[model samples]
Target: MALTDTAIKKLKPSDKCTATRPDKYSDMNGLQLWVRYTGVKSWVVAYRYQGKQQNISLGLYPFISLADARNETTKIRNDLAQGINPKDERQKAKQKDNLDFDHFAQIWFEHQQTRIKPHTFKRDKGVYYNHIKPLLGDKDIYTVRLPDIMAVHDRLALQGKTSTAHKVIADIGRIYDHAIIKGLAPNLANPIPRGIHKSLVEHKSKHYPRIKITELPKLLTDIDTSNSEPLTKFGFYVLCYTFVRTKELLGMTWQELDFDNCLWNIPANRMKNGLPHVVPLAPPVIEILQTIKSWHLHDEFVFFSNRGKDNVLSSNAFTVALKRMGYKDKMTGHGFRGLASTSLYEMQYNPQAIELQLSHVQGSKTVRAYNSANLLPARIKMVNDWANVVNEVKQGDFSTYKAKSTADGNEMAFISFLQSLRYKEQEIQDELDIHRMERLEVLAG
Candidate 1:
């Protein structure tokens, strides 16, 4: 029969000299009340773990109430469902260090400062504090199991933070890595299961919205008239003028700009490909930079956060503004890249120069090395030309937005025509008009 609180209070233990015996009554589920018949009793749970039968003493009865015993029994069963042995977990916890998970993770986070870029650290720190800490901060590193991590992932996934759920895989995974690295928990395994990210919900929404080249005029006019933050509005212009990734633009610092050289040098740590990228600024872009500088918005970064200088403008700044401008799903911050690529490809700028300027990774090692730095002149010309084309489009001057004609015998035009003829980059005729080559060099300079 099921035991109740009245019966549990009535329970009594039977005492003996050596291996004493107690009168036992099965309570709810796996819990049983043991009575010594001497007004003393306790609780014990019996279960199987790893092909062996195990009995664990819960605690003295009355102190561990009937409700507490039932709750703990359910918890143990849940842990077993995830292949976790509660007995083994308790054993590990006994061996665990005095420091909790958050304290150790904080130390690891600080140590990572010299190893990662500022923006990356900011993002990782957010994950650590917002997602992981609440659930696992006080958990002993050795006692934290796969169920704990899955709980964090499930919480994020349920809240529609699937991308953050995916990121959590690495966030907590590294904490265990550093713990092992520092010899803190030598026997502790990473509670996060490997290949666990495959099961997290994927971002199934439309990736980004873009406008056609024909629709460029409307996007430009709407941006100029946007009633958003001034910096946010200028962001659209910079996106149009430079076509770099939005994060790259948001993280733009005064230290990265070289006004005299008309260049925006992005360090390798901030770049996607881990290669330093240089963007040649057009006259329009230089003017925008000057306008932003006049605001004195930040001491270091161009896009300043209202919170503090260390914090940056929200990543959603443009997307939120776009929504307010009534473009909800019809436009996005990243759409600028697609628009620029479409315009340049149609304008007959060298494909190599366009791709290089877009910071695309080249397939061929030799070609990548040859194009990485060697395509700057073409990139500069392309930027200036595209910037002008955008300006003209904004002014409704479609007549001047014509493709460079290959039939015109202009040296660069001849070169572009020659490039169009090749299916793949192959050896071309070495013969060229000496006067045309000289003129081409002068024009390039």
Candidate 2:
């Protein structure tokens, strides 16, 4: 019976045991709220589960309002009329705990933490906690659709974090897989299916701007003369000499440097290839190392963070220095590799030797697996020569220097021909005279 105002207001319990409603209360279909013998009022829905009449408690008074109780009771009645057991269905749903995207995401993050490096795990967690979780955390994992993912993508794009959006979507997909595997949610469609990123986001190529070979001397000189911080100057020197990745250089430690042997042993864990690398030090590199050594009394890192001994130098310090030198968009820390590689090739060093110095894989298939120990000597010489070349350029010595061309011998033939003509002008004139006489005779005949 539908609840009346008088029934709601005057609802009270009776002695012994009895169930009664106000005179104004009259409704059909599902059970209604009634006070028990103890005077505690609660809602009950009369339904059939597996062909037997049963009473399911909706909830207690005030907690489940009258309107909500009625609505829930109606739903229970509809479920019973369709030969469905509402109690069994509710139990099945309750077993899964109605896990939402955020809850399962925490599980996913914990699982990922074991598989990735600490730094990488921190970054992934930051993306989820700072961005993804706030937007879709409360949504049920099973109910999170493509539109919802796309909405996050669109918002992130507007905020100029498109690449982050792509990564977040990928993370969300992994979280869903975790939910499925753990039985927290059913196996459904991944919001970010294959090729979906292209339609929803624009792809931008990462720009790696390198300093011009001839301009290196002036640039380094300017860097040295500038009133920048000592750490900034040292970072620039390290980048120019080592040609290691920016992050690796920023994270360098005093333990990694062997001043006696003049070598920097970058450990495998910090390297992209997961292989320990040996870098031969040049005179200038050793000089910079000595300078850093004088400054470091007890710190483990060669580049110590200003904050404390435990931290390394900031990653953005070098980029900021470049920007201060008016090279904001013209060069970057990673661009040092490109400069070194191009300059080494231009100096006629063996390609494999240069690649080895850069810690790159030599070749494909069998050659890659076959690590040659003989290249160390050649790499040492190549690196030294590269350093000397950079020093000379930095000292404003451009005599006998030429811009490095990216073309092969065949492509350079025209350039060689043009250069040769300047010296062989008389020989070219005689050949042209002979050709002109032959053409005139043919015309006369």
Best by lDDT: 1
On the 0 to 100 scale, the lDDT of residue 264 in model 2 is 84
Q: Residues 28-111, candidate 1: write the lDDT tens digits.
A: 667777765333466888788889988777765554678889888898888789999988876676456456887678668768
Candidate 2 lDDT tens digits, 330-436: 88988898677655554456666766677775456466445436777887776777777677667666442333322231223323332332425454444335334
lDDT value for candidate 1?
0.74
Stretches of candidate 1 off by over 4 Å are 1-107, 204-206, 225-235, 246-261, 266-275, 287-325, 345-352, 360-370, 395-445
lDDT of each: 0.74, 0.69
lDDT score, candidate 1, position 74: 90
